[model samples]
Target chain A: MPRLRATAIIPLLLLAASAGCSAPGANDDDAKSGSGPIKIALVDAQSGQLSSLGAWELKGARLAVDEWNAAGGVNGRQIQLDVFDDQGDPTTGTTLARKIDSEGHIAMIGTAESAVTIAMAPILKQAEIPNITSGQSPGLVAAGSEFLFLNGPTSTTYDETLAKYIVDKQGLKSIAMITNNGSYGKGEHDAFLKALSSRNVVPVADQVVTTDQKDFSAVLTGIRQKNPQVIFVGAEEVESGLIVKQARDLGITVPFAGAAPQGTPVFLDTAGAKNAEKTIVSSPYLSNDVSDASKKFAAAYKAKYNEDAELHGAKAYDGTQILLTALKSSNVATGKALADAIRGTKYQGLLGDFAYDQTGVGIFATSIGTIQNGKLVAVTG
Target chain B: MQVFLQTIIGGVSLGAVYALVALGFSLVYRTMGLVNFAHGNVVTVGAYLASTFYLTSKLPFALAMVIAIAVTGAIGLVIERVLRPLENRDFDLMLIGTIGFGIVLDALVIAIWGATGRAVPSPVQTEPIDLLGLRIRTYDLVVLAIAAAATVLLVLFLSRTKRGAAMQAVAMDHEAATAVGIHVGRSNAIAFMIGAGLAALAGGLVGPLLYVSPALGGALGIKGFAAAILGGFGSIPGAIVGGLAIGVLDSFTAGHFQGYSELVTFIVFTVIIMVRPTGVFGERTVNRA
Candidate 1:
């Protein structure tokens, strides 16, 4: 099969070589094109289940790229941003990762869904280039991909923060966790359970759901029997919203806490404004009140795109800005040096003072916020 | 006891939705002798229309529901006509064709409304009613009532009315029905319209619980198909029975097995298909000439 495939590609390669024969030094000049826009790739679900989050990330990248270009193109070289839709499919993501590597982009930022990021990890690591990811799964960086850097607080971090808040701050005697069985959900579920155990707190109920399963009435009924102080959700926006809404439908009015995905517009919208009240989310971005940098980013994003910048977009913007900052200070930064520079540098952006740990994970504090009357009202920062 | 009661209540609401979608499938199968794969997307389109008219356009919910159902019926008519032109009515081709058309519909909905799901308000409050120590949503009761009413109306249309008798004739023997002056083509079109309209109603009714999105069509589509198969391909009561069975199975599994419930639902469907292809109570009798 491999030999047959290789034989098939031979003609395409010959055609490409025939095309490159137009100019002898043209290929060289093109490779070393001075003052040209530096190509950067983004891989995300532009048309599948996670497309909404993918669009937000794209918008955020555009904002960061435009802001930087407006300020003068990273000291003479403009940024060339390209996008590839992975549809949150690992196979598609792997192919896109190879395409980006073969295209020889300076860096890549993307993959809103963690499974895709993890799928592309080995390919990106093999390419020996910088790849920043905003996905929540620890597996994105945990795959030991030196090139893959986590751009935001991970699911583990959020779960830990949520568990700590409920136990230490709120002083809840018990809690319940409901999550999907996917990679993202499972990761958060285990991490949250671990955190609870570490705190010597036992959850009253633990339920697992599928990504496609929408009805939570049955599960909520069982959980209501446990009657915990709060419910922690480990699902995405749609599923999380459904869980909260159905929980209310089943007459369970306890406060619900969740990770970043829970506090999103779609979650609040799908869950209903009234149903979503008392639903707390752990975020790394500004929930309601904006900091100076956040205000600038939001204003520019709104002025340009005529839309609100969400958490996914905000984190991507910060990640892009960090890449820009790294590219600026070092004129000849490439490959290992670029990755090293990204790790070494510490910059304060929209999410706050941002830096990566030794293992290429973002070290950031968590903020608690709730959807109150259709708006994310920050309780703590 | 409460868990058992709550599971039954939840299952009933879910069963009503499955029944609506399955009823559409059964009607099309009976009339056309072919399963309509696009029935699911009809539901999705219905959802999008409801969101656009009722939620986004600020139209009254009842008015929006009616308009969406009417438009979906029209869409069904168009799809049936489109399929009628094919040179060969091969089962595999028809299956693929309808599925391909459904995908096209999916893309159209996504293009117009975007991929993210949104919530629509229900006439009843989302809050549950305490009925003898069991928690049940008022919305669930409404969905159950609507589904029951629609089923009764459908049964009446097929049994008591002129068109109803004609449909039964066509279902029994299309060529014989045409010889007796019943327009088989017209019957097929009506079947498609009723199927699509029922699907749309199901989508609209489910919006408050599942939220309105093109993605809603997918899982519901499969379950509805399974329900149709389980109950009997051309049996109206079969669709209801099949839907209720599947819904109850799903809720019970979700409560008992947690994450693996979907797997169990499909596994049971697979087993039943392998064991009894004609389904429970499905007529497998052949008329001796």
Candidate 2:
């Protein structure tokens, strides 16, 4: 009887899921081009290790959509942004791409994970649905999808700026690197390595770890033996935080450097305030107080979510704004026209001024920041 | 030399955690003839429970850990009860059931804890102390001592106690043990409870090393399984030895080889499996009946 009940419920669950998938564009024909709510899909890792990224992206995009709706949404159509959990898996991401395209989503926001974004790019390109991703992986650009857009500067820009500050400005050349073998980590590894090589600085130790590895003791110990002046960590927030924490526990007192994820609150809290201090970060959005525009965005974001805004949130907000602006300027254009509109749209973002090129990379620069008292502060020369 | 000692200490510390987890697997498999795949998530649940009790409720860490272990053991009893109905069914059915149980536990953790990683504070100071010219955390040393003591007590319990003997008898031959008036069901329940309690204890001990998160179970679970298999599945002493060996080997390779830690460890594991189908300490007898 129990088995029979479970078997009976399985199909119902599937049916409910399919029903939920198609609900966003219920009036499909009208949503495609006619008068209807502008349907956009936000796909991200809503659960799993990368869910924090998903939460940030969702909030930022939601904030933008909410603000726009309050001020009479684009072209007199209230934008309906539906969210889908990609679970941080590329296969799930590809499946979501199909679901969103079929559901008449004009555009997509998110998949902060680079691998997922890269996996979904081809399908999204074939469907001609414009997507703005928060992933900074150079591989995302290398995917070479015209419909694919990056909300933030690529890892190349981030690491180059970081390298300049570390090797040229700070004059630290004896660097060590520890990166995971994931898409994001690989991108950072290569980009940072290239930047270091260009500056004639070779990392004394380079350790590539598995993405899911929790125990960083052995790798950190090996790096300690090298005695590098600075450690260039190229993993995500949690892993990087663990690395720093373990490094500190092992009594390695040298400062660490990284791009983007190293500056977040998750990293700060995970590593503990004392351990995360002096960690260098290169990011387009340094803090929530960079400018008056940022101050307003951060304030509004805090009011809505009751959480401090970070780089990912800022990037998502910028991307969503760019998408909405393009949609409006092009008069609710769909397909290639919308993609072109996004490419052509120019606006100032919380991160920086956005002028997207043919390659869909809008921003090209990042500023250096240091973790001071558990807060990521802009580093002044 | 200092690096080698550091690696050894780190490996032993990690191995102790794995030993606790592996014991859970060995106990369940030994007594019930069922490999409890949900044992991995039990470790996760244990960690999250300890975090809640210690961090949120402001309970003393030791008391919190005891409560966590008790709760985890209760969960184990529930799982055993659920699986009891499927005992006479196919082995594959039981295996799949345990896997499903693990998934449910994983989902439950996410639902309750909300998927964000939370830091579990170490009871001992996190700072390393230089001992014999090698830096090691006091927490790691404490874990090693606790695990060692637990293993010794467990081995003694199985060998010297009446209930342990009954459990051994059930493990050896379920029908024969039942015929001899040994309550096989009670034995199975006790084994599961103790096994799960050990896993929870492991989780509480290792929580500070790895942040308490939903994904923590899957990462550490596979290693525990590997340790159990390598040490000889269902062998208590074997589990400890296997776990320590794997930890040391992993640390040695990871410290020396930049990107080949998993490869080297697996190569050694595979070689061991190929050489000894029954594992390092597994008995030659098979009591499938």
Candidate 3:
């Protein structure tokens, strides 16, 4: 009886140890299994001051994923999305990128603002994972990161268009430029100067404001002294709104023009409709005019989120579409293969036709929009 | 000259709202010896509640403002009750608690309302009146008038009314007031309620001019705090003066310098602190029985 009992106990112990070892092994196998869905990561600002825009981007990306998965995902494998909120901070963005990289996503679509995207570039590059950013910062592509891609217009393009608009359309002879002092702001300022120099138009005053600034009285006073016919703002919506509101209070009546950051709804809300109405901005997409893809995405987004998708949403959707298309075209599912395929992509999207140049900047056209009656209206292409 | 006059007028009007917000901070700090860091969040809650009433319930603007003030006052009471247990705790711990509470309020707002800057229609007419050669919005003038009335009423109440006198007694000396038959807890509650109501009023006034968003309170809060500090933390008149001064400084700096308004404001604040550490109207305290 004792011998039989010992034999039974030994078999049971071996079975239990095998089960314990296989449980974790099964989890590892589940993660490594190519037959399962391909996971993609999205890291962007989903909280803080820019949360509204961030949520909009999330809605658009989610819609694209839903549509892609429904219409037969890449090679019959569903696409799974893992989203991270960086709160619009560059440091937080870098940390999130590292975490996402370690988790081993096939690719990432994200980082709406230029500052965060530029900070996240090294992490994604180190992991050999390709990422398509929604930010227009040229620095992301300028870094020569083989894995980086930009889906928005660079400051150079926007400045060229803006300078032409102010000089030709508005007939402004003298201009004053007030820009935030940061990488994004500096890029815009440099681009504006270059474009104006090309057109033989010299600015009467060029001034800089720190990003943390809330007051603009001294800057406005200087601009008032110069008495330029127009004022150009190269900053995000919060500072831009404060500038406009304060300018009106200070009785400076120059027409205000800004880049894509000023085109958001937050600008109107923060500065009031009266102040926002005087501003003109350029963007790649407007909510009013919907292409077939945009309309579908908007409908799905509204149904799920009960709100309209803003420009950030449209860009995220386009970026994800480009990423998924490249992944579908490439047979090898590794990160290197995905990066190469993305580099060779020429996909048409909601923003416009996207063709990446050698530097990984999306070669596309931008549309101009004006804030009228508290809504973004497309003005000119 | 007309443009300069209009600019000053506009600055004063904007300053009126800031002054009201600063008054709340000043009143609370004077009485409680604690800076209610959640004061701005209280303002935000008031603005959002008013927006909901105006948009969802279709209430009149006046009714909505009244309801918002009442709701925010209740919230203030609840906050005081929740914090009453920690009254004897260290000042830093209380401050950290308030900061944590502010974060909770901000997050709750986002979860409930989602992250969107909703448009709040201005009750005041949209017409821009010509002041000299410059056009000034009517809503701004109204804000100035309301702030003036609130200041006068608060001053009168504190000076004349029995409850107000008791409140002042408590602010002056909590232990002595309690020994002299004043209910210190009740007085504190009343002071907080009044402060919260003023903050809500400021919120309602500014909501039409600016959209109500979860993050809108942060900058305003910082500025209001700065205004209070500039004015000598415990003085009501100082808050008003300080707010107007900051507003004018901001306008002038932006108008004259174009890009260095923040630096200019910082310089002014630093100068003021250096010149008068006890604040413009603050009394130098001496340790005594």
Measured by TM-score, the strongest candidate is 2
lDDT per residue for candidate 1 within A52-80, as digits (tens), equals 78878888987898878888897677886
What's the TM for chain B in candidate 1? 0.94
- Least well predicted 10-residue stretch by lDDT in candidate 2 chain A: A1-10
Identify the CAPRI category of the predicted complex in candidate 2.
medium
Question: Comparing to the true complex, what docking class would candidate 3 get?
Answer: incorrect
DockQ of each: 0.39, 0.49, 0.20
lDDT of 2 by residue, A105-153 (tens): 8999998999999999999999999999999898988899999999999
Tens digits of per-residue lDDT, candidate 1, B172-277, equal 8878888999988788889999999998998888887787766788778889989988987778888999999888888888887888989988898889978988
For DockQ, candidate 2 versus 3, the one ahead is 2
Chain B TM-score per candidate, please. Answer: 0.94, 0.96, 0.94
C-alpha DockQ for predicted model 2: 0.49
Per-residue error for B195 in candidate 1, Å, reads: 1.6
Q: Candidate 3 residues B1-289, lDDT tens each?
A: 6446654765676578778889998887777777888988888888888888887899998799899999998988877777776775676787787777778777777776766557576677555675554667688788888899999998998889999888778778778888999987777777788888988898887777665777767767777788888888868898898788777766666555545666787798889988998677775241011
Candidate 3 contains a number of clashing pairs equal to 20
